[model samples]
Target: MKLRRRAGLFAILAAIILAIAYGFMPKPLPVETAEVKRKYMRVAIEEEGRTRIIDRFIISAPVAGFARRIELDAGDPVSKGEAITELEPLRSNVLDPRSRAEAKARVAAAEASLRAVKENVHAAKASAEFAKKELDRLRQLFKDALVAQEKLDEAETETRRTAAALRSSEFAVEVARHKKAAALTALKYSAAREPEEYAERVIIKAPVSGRVLRINHKSEGVVNRGQPLIEIGDPQALEVEADLLSADAVRISPGTPVLFERWGGDKLLKGRVRVVEPAGFTKISALGVEEQRVLVISDIVSPPGMWAELGDGYRVEASFILWENDNVLQIPASALFRYGDGWAVFVFSNERARMRKVQIGYRNGLSAQILSGLAAGDKVITHPDSSIKEGARVRLRKERTL
Candidate 1:
């Protein structure tokens, strides 16, 4: 009986020790996981874009004058050749002392030039009269058989040449007079003498039939020639401009499909790449990073009434399709980790973590293409950490969904 009790006690002590050892062993790590699956996958580049009129026109003041108050606002319909605004000559622009002096000198020079031209005209006229008389005399001599026909022809040619010279001198005088007038106008002397006379209304007309987009001048004011007055464009003819990173733009080509969204409409609009500008510009990102960007122009291919409410400068999101497949083996991008020069994933099998080297093709922010080293229905440990090691025992925190 003593031997039996001793044996039973020893067996109980051994069982207790074994139980303590088992309790001290490291417990399986609990991890969140996802199942790899075959699904439709696509790789695309997305960026914010804006709508713009393809044929925008800016109307500028045709002449420097007093621009009347523009009653027309943006979006106002305008017809081709229809007057949009009137500019009446205001008291000529104020001239500085130096400018006034220069104007006076120019005016005097022009008057002197005009007098010289007038004298030249008189001299040409006198020569022409002398030539005509000589020609008549020669013709009379030729008729009497005293002078040769060649001499008569020479006299007639001289008369014609002198007449042309007189006409040229007269034109020069007119040009000089115009110069004098311009000089006087520049000095503002004409305005000072006949202010009301300079108030003749000059009408400005629309160059094309379209709606006004912008107005630079609204109130009556003086404007210089070539100053912008309004912008006009056909709202129906619209395109989209997207600035993309230079790296992404290189992959885009003309005629690539595009999807436009978040443009204040429930339905998505369609567009196609028209051009990838050959040049790039430097842009500062919101995070203060300098980025090289290229312009990607896209034509709105959707029919009217679909995005009828869309207008110039409206913001939209654009997605440029790069590559896509209807069915592809894909895994969460988070499942991938850098391994050597390639990529790897922590695959879950037999309730343990297995290091896997994977060949990846394309990847976006959310998912990645699995070209090899993984199969459909395989479970991967998402967000793997240092605690996960080769052959490390793992327990699912919850059932992983495909």
Candidate 2:
């Protein structure tokens, strides 16, 4: 009876120990994954920049004056030869009265001198004619031997002296006429007239038909010569000015296609590289590093109606298409992994993670072109974690939580 009781107790302890071990056993954790879909991909470099009009004009003050009234503001339409701004004539209350009086007196004096010289010329001409006639009579008398040679000689000398006096009077007349003309010209300058005078209050006109972009002068003020007053540009004609690194600029050529965006538009605008400027300048980046920058001028390929809402100096983003390929198999950049000397990816197969090495082509920030080792409809792990290993059995979750 004792042996039978001991056997029953040992059997109960063993059964209890087996039940506790079963409850402490681990359960398989679920994992999520994705399939690799083949699609066309593009590799692009993005940059932040601003929009600009291809042809911009800076209208400046032709003369210094108080910029009394600016007839237009930014975005105002102006026609060719239109008056955009009016400047008040600079008036000075301190004009010397004696200066005006002296000018008038000089004019009168010049006129009087001219009249006197004319009279002198007339008298001299008459005297010269008389002297010539007297010399002819004396010569005739000498030839006929009716007078002494000495008397003929005296008459000849007197005629010569009168001819010299007449010539002197003629020169004096010419000098006086020139002086009078000069005095009249000076008088005209003193009385400055509108449109004819190159002085203050010069009307600045628009050289071309366009919209006003900037107005530097706000109130009535004086501007020096050659100072900028306003900027103008054609609203219909617009282009983008891109500042590219010098190294990248060398690879870009004219006629290359470009994609533009964020110029106050929801859709991307198309454009072409029109010009690559030969000059380059130094520019400091946001990190305070100095770099050489080159300007590239591009023409908007999109219709004018699309960009009509855009104004001058609007900010825009541009992407230059250095190269492109169509119908190429590609995958997301996250799906790739560096294995040994080549690239590899985790391809889902047989309900487990399979390690497959892949040959990669061109790779951008977003996608990578798969040359081999991957095909369309292959499920690959995008976000791989250390817990996942090669040949590890995985159950495809219905939803991708990551």
Candidate 3:
């Protein structure tokens, strides 16, 4: 019986010791883990972009004239040399009473000038006729040897002078008549301002084959020379313009591959960078942040049919691939943490967290290239908190609740 009592006491003491030890032992930390693997990795800069025509032609008014109402709407197809607009003579500006009186007086004065020129022409004709008669008489007398040769020459010279003076007077009459007519047209234009009143119209034609993009003025109105009238561009020829932050722009150069998305198309449009503009401009973002941006132009390399509907000023999301690798060792970016002037990760091994210093190469926002210290199939803790330390016990986060 004493032996049996001793055995019972020893069993109770063993149970108490085990309970105490269990209480003091460190608990395995619940951690999310990811595996290191090989993947086709790409480092890209993403930003919103816009689609624009490769060559945009802006048709402007060729002269200051009254434009006919634009019959073509935006998106209307146009062929090269097709007449798109007709410009009539500009409507006269509203004339004040004083100006109107002056115009009327000018018209009267031009009429008077024309009448005076006609009288002068008539007088010149009379003088020419009399001089010709005298010359004919002198010629008869000279032929009969009854007049001196010098006298006949003088008569011929007077006849020629009168003939030339008559011609000059006739020319002056025509000029005066033109002046009078111009003054009349100006006076009449104030009352008559219709398309039919204009003698001729200036027809503006499309310089290239394309669709009309914008119509600056649709209604008939006076347009000045060099004023933008319509914008035309070929929709099939598409290019992308992405405004990237200056810092990101420097990392990319010409020939960088680009992918366009969310541009109202089913296929992913592809392109290559054509130019990185040397100049930078200040832009205000939606967040009201002042950002220095550079324009990166890209040519769409895909077939025209893929993005045929895309026209100027269409929005798109552009991904500029700065670097790429066919197959690369990579891990979740969250798995890495700063460690002593380098980088480190807590690798899950044998149910414990093992701190490992690693060399990393390229890093996208979501993933990083593992240059060293990590291998394929290695599991590492991601989002490690302060509780995680070297040699600490850990378990797959799914295995337990927080």
Candidate 4:
């Protein structure tokens, strides 16, 4: 009986100690996991952009007058040289005698001014020609070491100045002719003894074959000279304009492939970068952050009919493909965590969480390319937290398996 009691007590004591040890031991951690995949991967930049006509034209009134009601509405198609609007003489309830005299005097003054401008244009042309020749001669002399750099620079500067002056003089000639025409029209209208109904109407025609984008004035009203009347452009010649961060803009160059989506179409549009403007502009983002942005123009390489539903100012999401590969070993970006000086992931090995340091190549918002320390079909824990550590026992929910 004594031996039986001792054996029974020892067995009970062993049971209690075993239960205590088991209770203090770390429990299995339930975790979500995903398999490392070997698949195609791409690193890209996404930004919202607007569609615009590549060659937009804004037609304006040539002279101040009473504009007749525009018969066209926005989106109305017209051919080149089609009359889209008319301009009639400004309705005048009274004609002043002094105004008539002033009109005649203005015509004479305008003629004198036009002649002087013509003479100036001729002088500017001669000066420009001389500057070009001087620049060419100085360039040759510079190459032979016969002229100093300063002299060469001065000659080049003078050439540019003369060219600019020549252009300005030519533009001035157009302005002077317009003024002369205005003065003559004023004189002719002032000579009318009664209301200016005798004045002829001027027809405004479409400068290009395109659909009207918008009308500045749909109803008849008084208009100023050079006031924009209508905007016109071909809807078929559409390009996307995206303002990208200057930092991102530098990474992309002309001919970069792009994919456009969410543009209210079932078709995925393909395009290529055409130009990255040399200049940058400041824009405030929706988060109130000031960002320096550059305008990136992209050409729609897809058939125009695919994006026929798209129009000016339409919004599109542009994905610029910076890097891509067909066969890449990648894992979810969330599976990675900072470990020491490098990045690491929790690999599920034999029902235990194993710390793995990995060399990563390119990472975007979702996936990361694994350059080393991992292989295909490896399962990695996602959203790892404090509960996970080296050699810790882990459980894979039934939905996930290695």
Best by TM-score: 3
User: What's the distance in Å from true for residue 297, model 2?
Assistant: 2.1
- Tens digit of per-residue lDDT, candidate 3, span 255-304: 99999999998889899999999999999988999999999999989988
- 3 versus 4: better TM-score goes to: 3
Q: What TM-score would candidate 1 get against the native?
A: 0.72
The order by descending lDDT is: 4, 3, 1, 2
| TM-scores for every candidate against the unseen true structure | 0.72, 0.65, 0.78, 0.73
lDDT by residue (324-375, candidate 1, tens digit) is 8979999999889999999999988999999999999988778999999999
Worst 10 residues of 2 by lDDT: 191-200
Model 1 residue 231 CA deviation in Å: 0.7
How well does candidate 3 match the true structure in TM-score terms? 0.78
The runs of at least 3 residues in candidate 1 whose Cα sits more than 4 Å from the true structure, single-residue gaps closed, are 1-8, 92-199, 399-402
lDDT of 4 at 328: 92
Residue 24: error of model 2 in Å? Answer: 11
TM-score ranking of the models: 3, 4, 1, 2
lDDT against the true structure, per candidate, is 0.90, 0.78, 0.91, 0.91
